[model samples]
Target: MKSVVANYMISRKWLLLALVILLILLPFVLSDFRVNLLGRYLAFAILVIGLDLLWGYMGVLSLGHGIFFGLGAYIMGIHLKMEASSGGLPDFMMWSGMTELPWFWTVLQHPVIAILAGIIVPMIIAVILGFFTFRNRIQDVYFTILTQALVMVTVTLLISRQDVTGGTNGLTGFSTIFGFSLSDPATQRVIYYVTLGCLVIILLICSRLINSLFGKALIAIRDGENRLRFSGYDTSMFKVLVFTISAGIAGLAGMLFVMQVGIISPTQIGIIPSIEMILWVAIGGRGTLIGPVIGAILTNSAKTFFSESYPDIWLYFLGAVFVIVVIFLPGGLMSLGKKLKRRNSNEKGQTNSKADYSAS
Candidate 1:
């Protein structure tokens, strides 16, 4: 236990150093477009981490995370539109034949309410869904299918409501965020930094959370719910709590994503996008926290690169990457590190045994 703790401490310090270097150098090395791409990826990294908390560690395969993400994005998008119009209708609103903003749009005028909604809406939904689902002991692929259905239902609702949701076009033409002109390079950089800071903060929070007693309980449930239940732990409540945490984190990521991308649409919350989110965690390695973060960054970065280079073949390229990761790197990139560590440990043991044999 002492050795494990010490190794974790050292690894954390190293990861911290890596984050510092990336934040310092990334903006200068990348062009504005690339920086924006990275910003979006960083936001998704938060989402992946949140997904990892529930699906990766707790054995919950959620295909509905995109819905939570979209909810948060929509909240932030409304606020951006409100700030741009200064309490009037957004540009899309004008194009859609709406002369006046709705009553709900009034709350968006305040950034605080918008931000709170971004976090709270997802949490509320997750809590409600989780309460019934966990209470009924629904899990595994059954839970995943239900989640996918929820996303489909939400997307259908959003698409059907043309006036309020901007219909298929889905909320665009945002002017500012919290008084900062998003179009300005300075503002963009500030947003990027804020995103990086958020990624770091979420990483730390998750690390601590996973190491706590609550985290241990979730792992217990993940490994063997029957045993945990027998041991007097309320497995269902633990699952609900973890699920809610995952949803909140996804919401946070969604808010950051809308700020950078300047739009939120039904397409983002649809079934395909939700599956892609799972791919992000799967390709990165589900059980390891760091794996999801690395996976999101690499996969999204690759997507940007591929789309820019060969727009026609980017989807195929992404598909191939997913196939390759699933086949060869079942543990994700983080597993490679673990494999190397074990190999090194074995070599050291052999060397120590040989030295002792010689002394004897």
Candidate 2:
């Protein structure tokens, strides 16, 4: 029976069913506020899973995922604003002294366009960035720094364009998504479920991608770039493709976040948040697909709990957790759990050995 359960977990369909069941039942068990917060975390998990594919599997450290996420949120925000205004100007535009919606905002009248842009804009940006970076054979610490630079550039641009991009304030007051009134509890729950559904879909796609030939190639590239290149792989193209896919996933996460939170801002896409994102991937265990999801959920849950209980020392707690994870369990929380179980097994083995010796 135990083996059967284990085998079921190893199957994607069963794993997905289990995840869906947990998510579906969560709202029943959790308070509205907590359920909503989990919705936000689910969005973050999507981004983390994508990052794990690139950084964990492909060894491509990206610090600009926040930019992609922010882009998607902003795109969705435009559509939400349009939905609220009914072909009029977003309130922020009026407040900023604009007589009419900007020309770029025109396309936002169509939800389909906004959704497509959310996916495409980030992908295009990533492809452009990857083209230059990968072509130059950038990797490791240098690539990380480049990604950080990308985040800084994006944050700076958004902050500088107050009238256009809402500057540091960014886009907000998104009162609706589609035809649904976001203020309604039913609509909010529906959005939450939609986010949960997206999470499950992304997880399955990621699992499949990681287990397929393409996934093997990515792992190979991570393990030995030179060998992969020698073996006739167009490594740069692979990097570009994977990077774009990662950015697009981040965009999807951003859209889900904006739907739940009703806001998008430069602060949310800044360097600090980018660093925190990498931490999610790290503390989750980079190479393992499930590690990032675990890390995001656990870290976010800890942050929520600690901030409410001891807001003054929450940063210290986060720091302490990072330090402990780094020092004792370099592979991450997942590895830490495995280590404890292994130690218990070793101790039990020793006890059994001693018992047998005594009997002899």
Candidate 3:
């Protein structure tokens, strides 16, 4: 058992090294357009990692992560809009007949504050929602439904307050970030690099977390909540903490997404996108750190290709992919690699046993 564990750890280290090398080399190899697209996908990868942590490990399925993601995007969006406005009311607000910025918008003028708020606001919201729901022992489908409702409520609020949130049009017309012209290719590359760095940092944080005792508790809660509770652990608190942490991670992803995409619209924060986020995690092996990144990149690449080449049938293609993954690869696409490795290990073990017998 010890040898087996050691071998698995060694394999994981090699896999991690390979991933790091590929990511570092990708910018040099891919075209500017492709790199930008990858930046967007990496942001999505970050979002799905948080979702995987919650749903895959803690057994908490939240269909409303879009709310947290959008909130974070809007935080950055407001700052960009403010910068573009040049101390005047934002274009959307002016169009909506508002003479002044809203009180909340005033605070976002500072980029640092906005970025920090982008992460913290979602975490606070998650804590509040999780605290009440978990304390009440809302689990499984009911919890999922609640999260879906959160998406609806958030979308409605943003749309109704068009003057503040830019309404259905959402936030756009971002000219610069911290005085750097977004249109400049160099600036774009810098943003992409920053996004890549953030993803790497988030992956490291999650890896550390999942290997810790807290992670074991989360898995315990997933596998047997009642058993864990009977073991004298406050399962509710554990769930709430993990949920809040996941939301914070999603927020960070959203911030990076807005930077790369240069837009944050209500459409992106709706039920469909939220469901798609879940699908990314599902298609990737949940409970596996690297799986969500693979799922997001591959799934989005396919979506982009099909949407452009076969626009009318892209949805169908996506639906088929999800169905196939669910039915045939429930352990997700990553499981195939694991299986092959196990097979090779077993073959080597058999060869060693034969050699020993022959020696005897």
Candidate 4:
């Protein structure tokens, strides 16, 4: 089994290397607009990876990942808005009739604090949620429903707090980040590279984690939580740890997204987008690290193309794609590729065996 796994990795390594090369070359070859889109898609890819880790490995489906994502984005957004306003009220705040910066927003003026809060805040939320849910033995559909409710509550709160959160508009108009003008092409390129680097780092970390004994424990929990519990493991603790890590990763993705997209809104943190995040993981093989990245890029690219070409019919097309993937390609596109490769290898072996028999 180890040998087979090693061989599989060896076979896939070239493809991984090619992908890295393509990412590195994309900014150089594509127009600025296209590069920006790629950067945004990469951010989504990071979110999908975290979702895959949670749902695919641990069997803990969360439809509320957007809350963590939005929290992180808002943290960075607050910092950028504060910076842009030069320590005064953000534009939305002024428009909403705010006289002074909110006390909570003051400490986030420091970029370092904002970034740390972006990651740490989400993890803290995840820890609290996980503690309650897992301790109460919530799993499967109940857990999923709870997450859905969480997203709804978060969106409602953000939308209602017009003065504090900018309401429907959220936050935007970030001119510079840490002294670099966002409008500068060089700055955009640097941000794109930084996002790509972060994605790669997160992928590496997840890859190592999933291959470890802890990852095996996660799988065991996924397969049989009760059995694992009976085997003398603190399954709740594991669940909380994995869930917090997943939220932190999502938060990191949100920060990268805000840097590239320049806006963080409640709309993006709502139920539909959260569901789309799950589709990204499912359409890619969930258990596979690279699959979610491919799914995110392909699915979002398709959505962009279809929505541009046929805005009214894009939803039907997307629904059909989801249906077909669920019905026919249950293991996802990556699994299909693996199946084809194995079939071809088996056929070649059979042909070689026939030739040997003929020679004998």
| RMSD of candidates 1 onward, in order | 5.3, 5.9, 5.4, 5.5
Per-candidate TM equals 0.91, 0.90, 0.93, 0.93
List, residue by residue over 48-135, the lDDT tens digit for candidate 1.
9989999777888889999999999988888888887788777767777888778878876788988998999999999999888888
Backbone clash tally (model 2): 0
Could you give candidate 4's per-residue lDDT for residues 1-360 as a string of tens digits? Answer: 577668878766666677878999989889998899899999998888888888878888899999999999999999999889899878788788889888879999998999999999999999998899988787567878988999999999999999999899999999999989998888989989988898888888998999899999988888888999999999999998988999999999999999999999999989989988888887887777788888998899888888889998988887887788777776677778666766797878843222110100
Alpha-carbon local distance difference test for all models: 0.83, 0.83, 0.86, 0.86
Per-residue lDDT of model 2, residues 1-360, tens digit only: 577446534663554577678879999888778888998988998899999899888888899999999999999988887888888877777788988778778986798899999999999999999999898797666878988999999888888877768777778776777887888878878989988888878887988898899999998888788999999999999999999999999999999999998888898989878878878877987766677886887788988898888998988877787777666666775566556756797878843222110100
Clashes of each: 0, 0, 0, 0
The per-residue C-alpha lDDT of model 4 at residue 52 equals 84
What is the alpha-carbon lDDT for the whole of candidate 1? Answer: 0.83
Top candidate, metric lDDT: 4
Evaluate model 3: give its TM-score. 0.93
Compared with the true structure, what per-residue lDDT tens digits does model 3 show for residues 113-137? 9999999999999999999899979
Model 4: weakest 10-residue lDDT segment is 351-360
Error of 3 at 101 (Å): 0.5
Q: Which 10-residue window in model 3 sums to the lowest lDDT?
A: 351-360
Q: Sorted on lDDT, highest at the top, how do the candidates line up? A: 4, 3, 1, 2
